[model samples]
Target: MTGKIRVVVAKPGLDGHDRGAKVIARALRDAGMEVIYTGLHQTAEQIVETAIQEDADVVGLSVLSGAHMTLVPKVARLLREQGVEDVLVLAGGTIPEEDHEELKREGVLAVFTPGATTTDIVAFIKSSVAGAAA
Candidate 1:
């Protein structure tokens, strides 16, 4: 709505795998949104700092280290603590269905597990941001 949606795709914690994050970043860019990838091995602080610096509308985390429970909330908490309350936080990776509610309660907008398509990610982001604006 306000120019192209600005998103920061980050790989937080000890997760060494970045192929998924890279693919999502390219897909988001291809869909006409501005994507800032923070690369891999980012701390929650780094991700939140980058989001604020970039004035990101959305923050997407890619985690496959089974640490989503710890990592997601840390990122969300840091974002709020830094006063970026309007930033939409989301995650994608090996998260389980049972963890969805807990993640949402911690302020994650949504969580996409494996097998989620890029189109769905893009669409969900666009609609979620748009809806939040409305």
Candidate 2:
């Protein structure tokens, strides 16, 4: 809580679409959070390891491969298995409204679907982290 909110922006599974991830990473950085982007095609294991190594407060995942149901929860489970209970997991890209509640139940703090603004995302991260610290 004393330092910048560190975030790991990752793309897991076979998804090659990275524009969204990059945009979010840049926005977070611009908003003063230290963001570590794990490039394209990362694995759940790699993401968790990165989060641990980076001492991240948040793990922001971007998936356009329609594997959100599979990959998102896998990352969440991996984080939990690694004893990362305090880290907030957020997802973006093509996720359906029907799956939102289920994803939250899986430990994802929030899901940003298509058309979610970068400004809103930044505000959410700031307010969410600050509120958690409170």
Candidate 3:
């Protein structure tokens, strides 16, 4: 990769809880990637816009509001609709196992659930973004 992986960490929908999102953002940053956190209550449009503006290599979405079924796919669809072909989309926080495969089909590269280590997340971004960088 030419530089550090650029990641957009976002919280979509009415998810009031953000501890997980903040933790991931800090981990990514500490791992040397550029992390742009969109804060709380962001819409799919806002997240996609930030990703495009930031030219993110990956978009790490954290949703704890049980709306991942709706919001996650929306963000993924928006990215594709906007022609963002290179950014790898990832999701985390309270995702059910049943929804994992569907999220992948909808364009989310991976879904990290509860108890996922920050080191693993860092490693995944590094490897995934490197492959995409090619």
Q: Against the true structure, whose TM-score is highest?
A: 3
TM-score: which is higher, 2 or 3?
3
Candidates' TM-scores? 0.97, 0.97, 0.98
Lowest-lDDT window of 10 residues in candidate 2? 125-134
lDDT string, candidate 2, 48-114, tens digits: 9999999998999999888999999999999999998888899999988999999999999999999
lDDT of each: 0.94, 0.94, 0.93
| Runs off by more than 4 Å, candidate 2 | none
Candidate 3 residue 112 C-alpha distance from true site, Å: 0.3
Better of 2 and 3 by lDDT: 2
Q: Which stretches of candidate 1 lie over 4 Å from their true place?
A: none
Candidate 2 structure, TM-score to reference: 0.97
Per-candidate Cα RMSD to the true structure, in Å, reads 0.7, 0.8, 0.6
Candidate 3: lDDT of 126? 86
Q: Cα RMSD (Å) between model 2 and the true structure?
A: 0.8
